[model samples]
Target: MEKNEKYLRAERKVRALKGFYIHLIVFILVNIGLFFIDLIFSHDGMWFYYPLFGWGIGLIAHGISVLGFGRLFDEDWEKKKIEEFMNKD
Candidate 1:
């Protein structure tokens, strides 16, 4: 049972990491396309930075959520929280 749980958690972490990578790739590709579009079509002011900045912030948050800042919310922390909740009256 413990091994199965570990496997599941590992799978979840792998999925999250894969998702972050995919998001990163998409952000890069789309931004490159947008840069060229803005460069060719617009001459008044540079507007590509709007979506780039907004999406970049979201990407950073996604990365932080997946990678985590430290061991603050790791599997051990999750197990502790689960036990704490289960033992509550």
Candidate 2:
């Protein structure tokens, strides 16, 4: 029961991490393409930064969701660490 829950949580984490990586890669590739297009087509001003900034912000949030946001170090992990330290003594 608990083992199954742990495994499910691990799988969810792996899936989220993989999705974030894929999103990052796509963001990079698509932004590169957009940059080139903007360079060749738009002649008045550099408007590429708009999408770059917006999408970059989204990418940052995605990274935070996967890596930060304290999801990884939730209560379960904290309790495990506490048990480990208590057992060490």
Candidate 3:
């Protein structure tokens, strides 16, 4: 990869990781706020878990895309394997 291309790829990855972190922070903050509101207003039934579990699934997906199994096919890994195979000649 060319120098600029490498920098661009790294920049994109950093941006994606940063976005995921921000998403997580927002999820936590919003869920905490909703839980409190539910506790004060309802107090009869726990309803926050609906959005909690729903959004939690999305958060998990985002985490997977950012820091989870998606790494198995990342560009750096692919290039390393390609180089390893080529060097066996």
Most accurate candidate by TM-score: 1
| Candidate 2 Cα misplacement greater than 4 A, ranges | 70-89
C-alpha lDDT values of all predictions:
0.92, 0.90, 0.94
Whole-model lDDT, candidate 2? 0.90
For model 2, how does the per-residue alpha-carbon lDDT over 1-89 read when each residue is reduced to its tens digit?
59999999899889999999999999999989989999999999788889999999999998997899858777688999999999999
User: What residue pairs clash in candidate 2, if any at all?
Assistant: none
> What does candidate 1's lDDT look like per residue over 1-89, in tens digits?
59999899889889999999999999999999999999999999999999999999999988998997634788789999999999995
Clashing pairs in 1: none
All candidates' TM-scores? 0.83, 0.76, 0.79
The alpha-carbon deviation from the true structure for residue 89 of candidate 1, after best TM-score superposition, in angstroms, is: 7.4
lDDT of 3 at 69: 89
Prediction RMSDs, each to the true structure: 2.4, 5.2, 3.6
The stretch of ten residues in a row with the least summed lDDT in candidate 1 is 68-77
Expressed as tens digits, the lDDT of each residue in 11-39 for candidate 3 is: 99899999999999999999999999999
Query: How much RMSD separates candidate 1 from the native structure?
Result: 2.4
Global CA lDDT computed for model 3: 0.94
